[model samples]
Target: MISRGIQSNKVNGTFYPTSFILVGIPGLEGAYKWVGAIVCLCYVLALLGNMILVTVISASSGLHKPMFIFLSMLASNDALLSTSIAPQMLLVFWFQKRYIHFESCILQMFFLYSFTSFESGLLFGMSFDRYFAICQPLRYGSIMTNTIIVKLVIFLLLRAVTLFSPCIIFIRRFPAFRSNIVNHSYCEHMTIVKLAAADIRISSALGVAEAFMILGVDLLFILVSYCAIFHAVFSLPSKDARLKTFNTCIPHMCVFLSFHGLAFFTCLSHRYGGKRIPPFVHIILADTYLLVPPMLNPIIYGVKTKLIREKVWKALHKCQSPHVK
Candidate 1:
């Protein structure tokens, strides 16, 4: 089976490998079925939740504003991010179908990194929307117009493709690959790049640079936006008004904290936690960064945002109601 699956690239009368194996969640082989089941459930829930968010936002005319637009885009990003990894992960866990074509792996890595960067960009855009709404209310309408929102979305997609494409190029050109066995559930950039047989200094450097450049900038923007927002809210004379304004930001703050917080710890544990922590712990943390945010975003918004909550409740009620004769 392994010999049959080995793909070859023809160049100068020589054949080279064009496939790789994904070692999904090493250790705990006994619990593969259970883990697969849980991963499947999370993937299904993420899809359903994000789909609901997108449908409600698109169908409801009242939700055509900047915030909901960004939310819908975010939901789309979450869905894409989860889809790129989850099904393959499930296959690996349940069927032991770990051999992935080299080209396919590269494509997966591209989408994964692109969606993550785009999500971060969307968060920054949402923060900007909130900043203008709360901190500069008088100019909010003028500055945060539909045109600006559209432009921001366009800019985000373009930036994601442009920034992450180079990582793919770098990986493709790398001279040697030490092993085909990838020690993670998904085709992550660093994980795949780390398998090269040659000095992968350039690829490693690029990965770190992309992380700090994109994620760092987004984090700084979110912080500055929220700081300015809090300042403006606190200065308001009416206590009720201050509370009312602050409530709008709670859901975004929750999402930002959960997503970035998981991401930070995952990176830390992978880099420095060393052999002190079990390999399973690292796998779980890495998967959490990909899975948790997608699953949690809709819940956060549905519970906190009045319009979305009402829309969802109404939809659920409609589904539950018996058909008229």
Candidate 2:
């Protein structure tokens, strides 16, 4: 398979593999079925949970507020992110179809990273919404108008595309690859770049720069926003008022920590824990970073946000007692 792919792309003078082999969980070949089953479950839960959130938020007029609107955007991004990685992963795990076309690999990398950037931007926007709602309650509505929200969403989409499009060019410029086998599950940027025979320092540096640009900047803003929010919460006149206000920020905080925590840990493991961490462990962490947040975000918001909780309960009740009309 590898020889054929290399030969086909060696037309004319240049060399590029037509397809790459995906070694899913390097040493866990015997347990591919079990792993695939678990992955399939997570994918389903992610899709189902995110889709439900989007549907409920869209169907109800009460959820037309800025907070819920940002949440629906987050849900949609989660669904897209999971869809980009999980199906290809399942194909490799279940059917032993481990070969991915070069073009498909590049497309997968684009969507995966782009949606990740979208999630980061959405979380940052949600933090901004919380900041105004708590610290500047009087101006919250005016500041977070529908027009502003629409503009913010557009900016995030454009920013992600404009920033990450360079990755495609970087990958395309590789003259040849050291090997046609990718050690990880999906077509991750670093994993694919590492396969190139040429010096990967530029690609690696760009990946690091992009990470700091997107994740680091967004995290700093979110932390600053929360600090200001907490200060305002504590200054409230009554304990109940402080508690009530702080509760509103809980769901966002949980989601922020989960997404960024897994992301940072996975990235660190990949970069620094090469000797200490097993290859499969790195793969698992990467999968968790992609899978856990999407599976957990809707649940966190559904339970912590009062309106969403009430709406979900009402939905379940209607389903259970269909004849009650």
Candidate 3:
């Protein structure tokens, strides 16, 4: 089951949100709101931050180029990622009931997968952007245009949808089980897949294949992008310019590593050493990967893009300016 209509699927074999403690904490009511609150806040921030990015891209005449267009797409994925998980998580946490219908759970799973895949692809795209800028400075302007960016966005969307279609096929194989307990607040893909009463060899294979495909391809592309970037940086005329480029990349790389890298770590831990790991530890790491990055993305971009701060002050000054007589 996915994430969509879990509340509606409370009865029958569809899916239900039963009252249960979240995975991170000991029990349901005593101390989970803190986690829920943080998650919800991140979602809110992501939504607003993305909107601001979209607005800035739209408003600024100077920013109406290919790079900002791609940034807008990445922001869109970030918004989707936050929206898919945060609202339901907040509702369940506050009300003490976390029943989710099977169909709804499946829908949610689809979105979660789709947005994340799209994000990874977008990061790969950004790496390409940087590569072109650094490596082929003269050609960068011609290579990235509005038409090309739009086409790339469409391609990424279609690819994400196509790649995740197998997840649905695999999910349908599970027979209805009596127990409806979901170890997590929102039906995480791995959490539900682990509970399948039926043989999930196919699903397992698909999951692994998807993981490797997305992670492997994206990493390869990113590596190529950075390799080109390194060449350019090394060939730069000044040491200060090289330092500047690396400094610009540091935050994005940290965020990139933290999000996908943590997922890779958790998958490995579960595969070879999960038996020894405590549930709380598992939950904390999983939640960290989910909740932390959305909050940080805006901060990273805002700091990296000085224009955002300048625009903010400019707007504030305009707002405080004296009214016309």
Candidate 4:
């Protein structure tokens, strides 16, 4: 019974909404303030942790290796990804400001997906760095030089931008919307696409294709890289040498598991959990997936890597010394 392109807001032949309403978590309206506080705490932690990692890496010339460079990139991306979602989410939760401008929603959707793609690409590149360092030590220098790293990063940025640009265009082209009420906290792609009264098969299909292309392919390559790395480690003649080589890979492997494990769980729950799981639970899981990784990655790296641990302690000591004065 809904009219197409005939709402109070219309432009040309399309139903152009000025804003969209975001219902933070259905069935949990009473706890909005509590949830807002928790989300704010998590955002602060993620931002501080990631920025510390970036600063440490940049200030220490000793950490200028290819692996550290990739870690810096990952940290920067995590900070960005979390920043893109948390402020808007807090606004909805805290101030009863549930409405987001249409242009802002599109921009949020673009950044949310683009940073995710960048993370996958950076992780894949880190795996390659590991493969070369462990499996081909002598040529690692020649293969992963500064020039090569810059080129790889440039490629990752371009790939993410190219792949997600169409999403913005497609969202703008919808002729009408069933409603402007988005069910989740942020302007997630599928949620936005579902609002269209017109067919969304193309958008849905592109989303699937993009997910497989980025996550599936990158995951496959990482697994292959680790397999070869493990094989090389096991074949080493001495236990000490093998142990040393394997230790270097442990942090990267842990990070890879954390990011991908949460991602797959979120994806599967949405796709198959139908009536078994509550909607609020799914939204919490999605939010956790974005927040937890940023907070955890730097902790994992700082603790596991001896040099980084030393640098962090030194920095802490220096700060305390200034306070004592």
Candidate 5:
């Protein structure tokens, strides 16, 4: 039979070890399959949920306000995030055609990074929104105006693109080797760079640096923002008002923990000494970052965000209702 599979890129002599390759395969196979299913599910829900969010928040006159603008932005960002990885991931897992065109791979990496960064940025934005609503309720309206929201959205898009652009440029320009197979299910930066036949020390270094850059730095910002928010919540005079404010943020906060924690620990582990850790552990942590977050976001957001549940119920009811004459 003709060779029925895509050729994978591999490390050449004196580079990474073959043992490294063997370790991740079985573990990755199972993990990717499970994660892949969840990702597919998330893509469906995210599509439905976010579209409804955009529609409901847009069509409803009461929701046509500053807070809803950011909510819509969150929905749109989640949609972009799922689009970045879910479909391609499901395909890579279900089929044996594991190869991606080099250019296409570059494009995918660009987006994967972009959307993920956008997510991180969006979470930070959400926290900021909560901060304004609770801490500076008097100024929330003026601060989160349409013009300001537009500016924030534009800034977020630009930041995500810029943060991830370097990886694409570096990889595409780097001299590639005969081995081109990427071991992971998705086009991830560190995993892809590992396939580089040429000297990739700089890329690897940046890869490590980027991990800390997001976690140590971005996470710090998130924590500080939340601290301020908590302080404001406690200082409020009415216990009922405090409870209501906290309730409003429970969904966003839950999604934030699931995604940010996984992304941070996984990437940090890989960046530090993952090469020494058994490839199975590496595979689970490394690849899971891409797969798990996309899958988890929908469930966490869908369940936690009351509006998502209501919209889903509305759609279901509408479906079950008989057609009118």
Candidate 6:
């Protein structure tokens, strides 16, 4: 019988731990060094790429529209999300330093979830921006102003913190932990919950609810926005014109698919893939899902967007010029 948080006779009345050990990538002992190096490279690229995107969006006068602003926001969020997990995972992999303080674990989990929620909010905002730009081009400027962007940023922050704070509080109430072994690469709400020796149904429910409330709602809106956009695109007279309009959405669509697809898989696997799958697979998937999107998003946008590509080319040329050397 699975002890649903019931304290066993093996321990005292109540127990609290100072730290938890992350048992990262269980079977890949010697190979973890190589894996760690690869993950570190991905982290570096994600940071560099996102930073470039943000800098370009900020400095380039042509890219100063609402769509680009939201793109920069997404890039910033991606950088943060990658930072929350990748560095620690590398530390664990390269040095075998897997033990993390309880408070630190809580902080990592908090920011990871919060950043993910905030990303969803930004994606929703971007979808709206795209919808207006393509579906109602005439009113796009009037509808999505700097004031609106500011209000959306505030809402994203509030929504993430408000929805996830109670989860941390509930986690704090767990009377004891049965184990100090976290089975994944990084700290997450469900991963921590499994270690508890108290009933965690409420926490579990809240975690699921949080995902549905944020990601689900954002997905719905994105789909609806795209539906309207597609309807409008199909009605356009020329194939060239339709393709030109859709070209703008291509990068965002790629990002949306990768981010949401990986996120949903991780969420489902965490909740349901308990006994059926090996722990190593789960760890690999979780780590991959988180790192891939951040690394991929900027590259996708750089390749797809003409203005950004031109800016990048000019910057590269400037750097390579003989006078600068």
* Best by the TM-score measure: 2
How do the predictions measure up, each by TM-score? 0.91, 0.93, 0.87, 0.90, 0.81, 0.93
Residues 289-317, model 6: lDDT tens digits: 68888898888766578888889889889
Task: Give the CA lDDT, 0 to 100, for residue 129 in model 1.
Answer: 91
Q: Pick the candidate with the highest lDDT.
A: 2
Worst 10 residues of 5 by lDDT: 14-23
Q: What residue pairs clash in candidate 2, if any at all?
A: none
| lDDT (Cα, tens digit) per residue for candidate 2, span 29-103 | 999999999999999999999998998899899998999999999999999999999999999999999999999
Clash count, candidate 5: 4
Per-prediction tally of clashes: 0, 0, 22, 0, 4, 0
| Preferred candidate (TM-score higher): 5 or 6 | 6
Better of 3 and 6 by TM-score: 6
For each candidate, C-alpha RMSD in Å?
Answer: 3.1, 2.3, 4.2, 3.3, 4.6, 3.8
The segments of candidate 4 whose C-alpha lies over 4 angstroms from its true place after superposition are 1-15, 240-248, 265-276, 322-325
Residues 1-325 of candidate 5 have per-residue lDDT tens digits of: 2122223333343232221121223456766566566667667877776776677667667567665666677677777777876677667666544656666767877887777777777777767877887788899988888888788779878977776677777887765443445566566677767776678888877776665665456667777778888888888899998887687666566667777777876666656765677756665665556555555554555555666567667767989999999
Clashing pairs in 1: none
Model 4: per-residue Cα lDDT over 1-325, one tens digit each: 4342235765544565778899998888999999999889888988898898899999999999999999899989999999999999999999988888888999998998899889989999989998998899999999999999999999989989899888789999987876788889999887788788788888877787787788778899999999999999999999999888778778778878777777766655654577798989888887887877787878876667788889889999998885653
- Candidate lDDT (C-alpha), each: 0.83, 0.87, 0.71, 0.85, 0.66, 0.85
- Residue-level lDDT for 179 in candidate 3: 48
- The 10 consecutive residues of candidate 1 with the worst lDDT sum are 7-16
The total of clashing pairs for model 4 equals 0
lDDT of 6 at 117: 92
Candidate 6: give the clashing pairs. none
Compute the lDDT of residue 8 as modeled in candidate 2: 61
